[model samples]
Target chain A: MNNVVLKCQSLKKTYKKKNRKLVILKDINYEFKSGHVYAIVGKSGAGKTTLINILGLLKKQDSGKIFILNNDVSKINENKASEIRNKNIGFVFQSFYLDPLLTTEENIKLPMLLNNSLDKIKINERVKKLLKEVELEDRETHFPKELSGGEQQRVAIARALANNPDIILADEPTGSLDPENEENILNILKSLAKKGKCIIIVTHSKTVREYADIVLELKKGILEEVSRD
Target chain B: MKNYLILILKRIIRDFKSRLVILLIALILLLGTIVSINEKTTEEMLSKETYSKYHNRLYQLVKKESYETKKKDIKGIPHIITILHEYNIASEYLSSEEFKTPNTDHTIQAYTADNLSLPKIKYGTNFPDKQGFYMVCPINMYPNSNLSSNNINFKITNKDRIDMQQYLNKTIQFQFENVNNMNIKKESIDIKIVGLYEVNKHSLEDNTCYINESAKKYIYDTLNNDLPSYIEKSNPEAAVIIIDDIKNLEEVESELSKIGYRLDPYTIIDPNFLIETKKINKTYSLILSIICVFLLFLILFKDTKNTLKYNKLLKYLGAKDNHLYLTNLIHNILIILLAFILSLILSFIYRGLLNIIIYFRPFLFSKNEIIFSITYLFKIFITIFISTIIISILNNVYIKYKLNKN
Candidate 1:
């Protein structure tokens, strides 16, 4: 039997605008196991982002049970939610949201800095290893502005791995990159998945879905599992 | 705890670097506020000290009639020793012939024979030893009505002596009589200027001439000795009593009142000085505290709100809320502390500037030895610290509510 890393049941998200309730997600049930890259594919406004936000604990689901490693997340408070996000989950954004003021190395070291549990030497060692792993060792001292789209995204990837999280959540990680940079990022994501990290990528690209171990489509507040070669 | 502190510090450094201009502006504002507050406080303290010293040295006393029953004996009552003694006293009369220039307008204070001892002189002389000797003038007499220095000419029996040397060997005419019945022409006599003496500066009467003991005796003896034999005897108009200590003045006054003597209005010279000083100090402190609190609250609230908004973004970037809060607090506290330190330095600089001004113009201060006293600095620190802490906590509460709502 496969080890379950994350499970979501009856997750619902409703948005209220001008006193009108618009249901973005309804009764969404999903299960994520270890060592598999899951891709949630959908067009814009299809609630892919909403689902990703809920899974990352950035937003609360209206009515749901979310269990991470057999711990129910809905019962936890904000601080515990943050703790779970900090220790077990990593996020990569479509905008390559690197802290613009920090150098690439500092950006990569941000998670450890925030956690503050790791000493400077351990942080430095982890950052160095991640920088080498992303093939951006020489670009560590450069800021986000100085780096290209692919290089910045690579720095973002290195930052996500800084805390050695068990789950990686990427929201359209390659949506801003060029064709060549997209392939590079996809290959990196694939490699990360091979290292036993449960990588979940939210994307509409067929290329990302091809690289993912499982592809799920969100259509009209419903989740449908699709097979990907 | 160590880890948390380190995390907070790192985040503070990052945010500071990110918003360098805002941080710099905050620093300048903080420094300016601190410096202004500290300088103002120091100036107030100096003024209080100046006023206190002068008030203490002056030893002014005022007499006010509390009841009609105590009115008759007011002047003779030694209220400084006991409240009851006020009944034996009479009123003090101060009048000026001309109100303008010192030379034209001469001030004359006429009191009973007993009231003469109230003014303790420091230098020059009081009345002469022999009968009908010389008139003693006030020292520190300036052209202005206000007494500035002890410099005055002596006029003995309508003969003006510009300098004291000329009057040393001369004999002068003197007269002493009741204010109501002054038969000065009939009883006037001549006495040699035996010696000179000085009076205390704190006395109520500035310019005074002492009547010789023998001279006063002669006036009383001549008046009383002839009164019963040839004319009607006159009652003693008033008497003056000087107490050893001013603290028991009220008790002495009350005691005198119990003896069927009407008590007069009296003044306590000692505590009045302290009371005036306390009033001035309280006003100064209150004004400064209000200003400091106003400025500090404005700065702290604005800065904290902006910081909290930034911290929310940090929280979204995987930082814990606690981490963000701590970073915001540390950064703000550090800026405030820096501003306080700079302000303290500025206060000393202000003191130095005041000293320089006083040095060039020595008359600005009554005393030539004006030193920068650190006694008020500790007061400033305590005031600023308390004000800043209160403002910071208020700001924190406001920011927390704002961010948490979002």
Candidate 2:
């Protein structure tokens, strides 16, 4: 009975397209617990990114409330939300979004820079540790452009775990990666989930869904758990 | 604060190339605005009453025909330091004109100055503290321009250069002549050469001399004492008006003009007229400052897409809008401060270059005084600072609002 790390109740979001109300998410209730990898599978334009963005606090939900560690965060101001995100949640995206100017080591140290609790020595130590976790110790000085697709993705994962957040939300993490790199990234996410971190990934790949502990299907703005055949 | 500074440095390093272009334009605009304001402030300084206390400039006044300007005529003019009468007397031995013509080149021009016009003494002493008929001549005896090899038979070796120093304590006879209606009267007086002056390095070699005001008056009076009753005693050939302030030149000239006196065409005019008057061109300064701010805004706006993309990325990394706002502010301020320092250095370099060019080739460029006031720099800095703050805050807030809307 892993503790539930994140929960959302009756979530709804809508947008106005051509004078018509288009619903992106409708009355969604979900609980994400620790030590599980949840794959949110949806068709293109099915609001998968929207759901993940709201859960990551990168975007605001138009209606309904969210809870992290049993504390309500829906009414938090952006500053507090940012603090919570920095401390409690991590995000990875399809584009990798590594600061082009930063080296692999520096990119891994980015989120830790926001954590005031970590001194310079601790930050450096954590960066080295994370680089080792991703097996990128040798490539620490290489810029994102210099790294392969898989190596860059590993650096992105290392960056997401920089502050040791309990929840990791990834959007199309393997969308641009090859088959071998995709397998490698999924195995890393699986290892993170085994370490008692809640990993939620939004994707369209069936292999990722099969690899996930629980698969959720998002269709027409509704989310439903699908049975593993 | 350290963390914030590090973040700012990171952001600046990443965007350094794109920001370099904006920095250059900002520097140019800043210098342009500074020049405009310097012009306006110079004009304002000219009109200020306190300026007279620290300034003194020279101008010459020549008496017109049928006009007798006495000391009483110029007494009422404000800012007049002193009116010294200038006299041209014939010196037989001291004048380099002797090489050219025994009669014509002997005319030596003399002036009466209290102390401001005294030349730097290179040898011997300056005029006595209790001055009475004292004179100071040039160290180098420059021949008259007409004393070329073709016209003059005078040839002197370096031995002649040694003889000029011997005249430091010697007395030379100066002839004071008055010619009236074909009547000629001549009086000779002995004046001692007390000091030798070091002439300017850039000036052509010339034998010019300085005499105290009392000596000039004594010679003028000796010639005027024998004049007929129809001629006035206090009338001078010309008067050199020493003004206490350059700023008061225009006003003093106007006052002198009102009293039937005109400045000599060769008189040195105040340099402020080069920038024009405040009423005519001060508005240009304000316009330039406005344009500078607007141009900065335009550059920032043109880069908005990339800036917004970076900001969004930082936001996704859990940065608050406030942090992003501060980062933008610090970035702009850093660029502006760099431009400020660079513009200051460039302006001083420009001033030095202008003076150098004007010094060597006087005909090619007019001499100008380019003064940079700290008050004006501070004022412009504040203007840019306020504008930068407002623009940075507005830009960040707008981006935040726009992102929220999306």
Candidate 3:
């Protein structure tokens, strides 16, 4: 009875490599529901990252229809796409892209800065809540460069949730972390999905697949759901 | 909006140190161009207004031929407050009957002019009017009976000289001579010595005397055989017209020119000259402004490039192109506003320093003084503001393109 937060139909993406048409994804159709973690696993050349980019609205698909919350957003312009991204989608990259000039709290407050509906007091309150949620409330004033790899990733996660996005698209969110930090990030993502957020993660890790509620494998420009005992 | 402004302020302060040196240089350049153009133009305009209001209304009507301008010829010319007719009479024909000392060493010349043209009188005042036989004699020259041999060296004392005061209010007989058709005619008149002028060390003005218009006419009558037909030739050989106001100068000049009288401006400067100088300064300031704009572009370009990483991050965080654009705009505006304020302050300091220098060595700057005005400051602010906006937009476009590409 869970609601479908994101759905894609007949998605197609291609790249030209050395004057040859190389197909990355073709006819990708899926409906992602809330309260679930969808792990997309693939080989190095498989199009897992490309699919996640398309789903996150960070990259344009050559041909497809994308719907978020029953609204068709496949042909919307960049500005509208950005509004959707700000209001509905959040992204966590593997590199942990944090503004070096801004402190941890300021980075978390960045997304809300563009949201006119949120006043200063509400934004500050939300930033503090996210900082505490990511267990970095004590490091709110620390800049990215001053934090450790795990701490920086925690700040990035807090930033990803700044506007309380309904859908989280994480591409190798823990790829650069140690096992201990990776476990911590995975647990946090799992908790977010339990709270009715649609979490889509692109990764090659076996542990992430085990943690996911539904695991999909992308191979040879096709997607196949894998059954686990 | 409040949040956006806070972010902008924080970024500006965070990047303050990195941009400090270039910002300072930009401030100096902006202040230099603004002060240079504004001060120069203000000086030119103020000087012209002062000159035109006080002394530039005098014009000499040149004589084209032996044809003299009759009083009837300039009867209808508006703003002709005065039409001065000046003439000179030889001093050899002049002798003070009561004083009895005649100088054979140097000739003393007597001339007539308007009161405005007369030199500063040390002992008495200028002629009250052109009528009557009034005269202002040089303290060392007239009444040769009073001068000691040492006084001839021009070691003339000031107005308090007792010997010079002796000639005041005294009447002296002037003998005038005329040669007509090989007939020598002579006449004499008694003229009063009313004033004395100080002998200037730099000129031969001490050997000269200033006579009234009536005395000049008496000499003219004696020289022309006292004939009424010779009266036209006796008109002032040269005439000077004084305009009542500056606004009426061109009209009066055109009227005079239309009447076949060639007028030479004594103090009124050519309007074309000022226009040409203004054009040159405008172009100069424009070039400086362009350079200032280019400098700002470079600064913004570098800053945007440096923050390209952050911009990319913001883009990934769902910032629209215009959102990023607005951020860059606010950033640039803050810097430009800071530079504008600093430049204004520095320009005032620059003007103050130049004034101090001029005060110490007045001859260096001469008549032109540095004048500061709010209009100039407003002009400079508008220029830099608009230019910074254009530069920011251009910089924004480039940054937008680069962000999309990356």
Candidate 4:
């Protein structure tokens, strides 16, 4: 698509266990576009998360190219990767990895802090705005444990949105939630998608697949288009 | 930046609180060990400091055991580097008197009051440049003062020095009686008064006189009050040697041994004293080192895991490796600064508490100890800096590697 946010080509990864090579991703290719929800579906250990992490620039691909926002990310140094990630890409893990010691407000402000691009006043203003967007303005003072599952996931979503990144990569975003929390988190992801932001979610849920604009299934270390909704 | 610092600080506060007891105990014990050891070393240094002040750069050559078999010749202090001379025989001022009957000479037969070993002249000039006939009237001192051998000899105090100041540039007749080997002979000499030395220079009632070679003809022994000092009354039985510097003591000793000259216990300065003092400090420092090393490992290992999550979180937030490294550097530096300050405070506290017990035999710090302390503190700071950098780099690399692996 013309609005492509991330594209991967011939990506591969492997590990050695007792001198035997175990390949994870083999010559995988994919394109992620803006203004759509893309769901990656696969069984456990099917390399769905691996593809997502490689796409997120969290891990290196063995022999291929990754381009984020039309620039080749593979040859970029660590500083550039961090810069692109902070400025353009956000992450939401299935565990809703909020800092346990921090309040919801602080959790949401963490990405912005790491990015180090925003001033305190701006970050504070942005944090307030994100809390309102996630409908957690009144819960800003509550720590992660004090929040419900749905509330924690919503906080994570707000954290992802803190830097207003161009893309959101959520790995099994609804994997650990109850049906209600799952539905709530799915709606949030779908809302972000509707707002013309790219949302990449790795999930095993049919409900998540139903809501996605595109679905890709991983098998034997490769991606195949399962459907286009 | 502000937000990042606040977050890092918040994490540190939380972690520190969680491990407050262990951290505090470890820090206090670690710093206390260094400080306690420093305090001990300081005291030891100060104790030797006074004695080392006059002797730090002094190296002496004693008569060889082999020479004692010959016993035919005595080599007294040489005039080339000679500041003062020692006379085994006692002398008496036949007439003039300031303090009273006295003997100030310790086993240290005599020393020339050079600018190095002797204090500034409070009254007259030094003895005459030529060896004809000159005398330096020592201040008559009470015997028990620290300058004399414990309590047996005479000593001159500040007051005696003031009284003796008038005797400067005044001639006095001295009677030297030789009673060696039961042979009795006497010589009377009218010595020119050249100068009066600082009275406090030798508070000991050392009946030592600075005389020229022309006056050496009268170094005879007296009958009544000559304490049985170790110096032989005759010359050629003992020789005085001066070392250029204390650091060269080893070389000088080796050289002197080749010439068959042993270390003279009779000399006030002994290189062995300085060596012994260093050995003591080294022993304590080794103990300190063991404790510090143990603490260093405990701190590093304990902190490695605890900081991993924070490190990962920062990295995830798009912190460059340098930023992370810098942050870790500052964090470790803060801890080290705290520990160092705590060590200094602990040292003073320990000193204050322990100094009372050591007050009786008060030892003052010497120039060498002062210089050593400065160098030692510099070394401590360099160590802290190096350790902080190393720990930060190693820990950051390790955490990054582990996180990447996972």
Which CAPRI category fits model 2?
acceptable
What is the alpha-carbon lDDT of model 2 when measured against the actual structure?
Answer: 0.71
Q: Which residue segments of model 2 deviate by more than 4 Å?
A: A115-118, A220-222, B13-17, B26-56, B60-70, B88-111, B115-210, B217-238, B255-262, B265-273, B277-291, B341-385
> What is the overall TM-score of model 1 with all chains considered together?
0.55
**DockQ of all predictions against the true structure, Cα-based:** 0.19, 0.41, 0.47, 0.41
After superposition, the stretches of candidate 4 with alpha carbons farther than 4 Å from their true spots are: A1-3, A7-42, A60-67, A72-79, A98-159, A174-196, A204-229, B1-49, B52-83, B88-116, B120-252, B267-274, B280-312, B320-345, B356-406
Residue B227, candidate 2: alpha-carbon lDDT: 58
Return the candidate ranking by TM-score, descending.
2, 3, 4, 1
Distance from true position, residue B227, model 3, in Å?
Answer: 21
Candidate 4 residue lDDT tens string, B1-406? 7666666656555554434633553454444344445544554453443333333333334564432432322233222233223342222333233333344222112233443334345567665555466666555423221343444223244443324555566665554445667886664557676765544322233444445444543343224326442234444344444443345556655655665666553445444655675676666545554555456556765877756776676666667778877887776665655555555555545444444344322233312222224344445445555755776677778877887777
lDDT of 4 by residue, A1-229 (tens): 3398888889989878899998888878888888899898888988888788778777887889998888989978788888888788888988887788788988888878777668888989999988888788899899788999889989989988888988999988888899988988899888888887899999888889998989988888888889844
Give stretches of model 1 more than 4 Å off.
Answer: A100-106, A135-149, A227-229, B1-310, B313-323, B345-406
lDDT of 4 at A173: 87
How many backbone collisions does model 3 have?
A: 0
> What's the lDDT of the predicted structure labeled candidate 4?
0.63
How displaced is residue A34 in candidate 4, in Å?
3.9
lDDT of 1 by residue, B1-406 (tens): 4544554445455565424533443444334444444444444433333322211222112234333333354445453321222222332222222212425223332222222342344444455433353333334321122333232222222221122334444555433344335643344445443333333322323333334334444445554564552112322233234444444545665765565443332332334444455566556655665665666666666566456655654565567766665665665555555545555565455545655564442322422223333444445446756776667666667776776655
Worst lDDT run of 10 residues, candidate 2 chain B, spans B47-56
Clash number for each model: 48, 0, 0, 26
Model 4 / residue A157 / CA error / Å: 4.0
Candidate 3 residues lying further than 4 Å off, grouped into runs, are: A138-142, A178-183, A204-215, A225-229, B16-25, B28-53, B56-61, B64-280, B296-311, B322-335, B356-369, B372-406
Docking class of 3: acceptable
Q: How big is the positional error of residue B116 in model 2, measured in Å on the Cα after superposition? A: 7.1
Error of 4 at A24 (Å): 6.7
Question: Over the true interface residues, superposed, what is the Cα RMSD of model 2?
Answer: 2.1
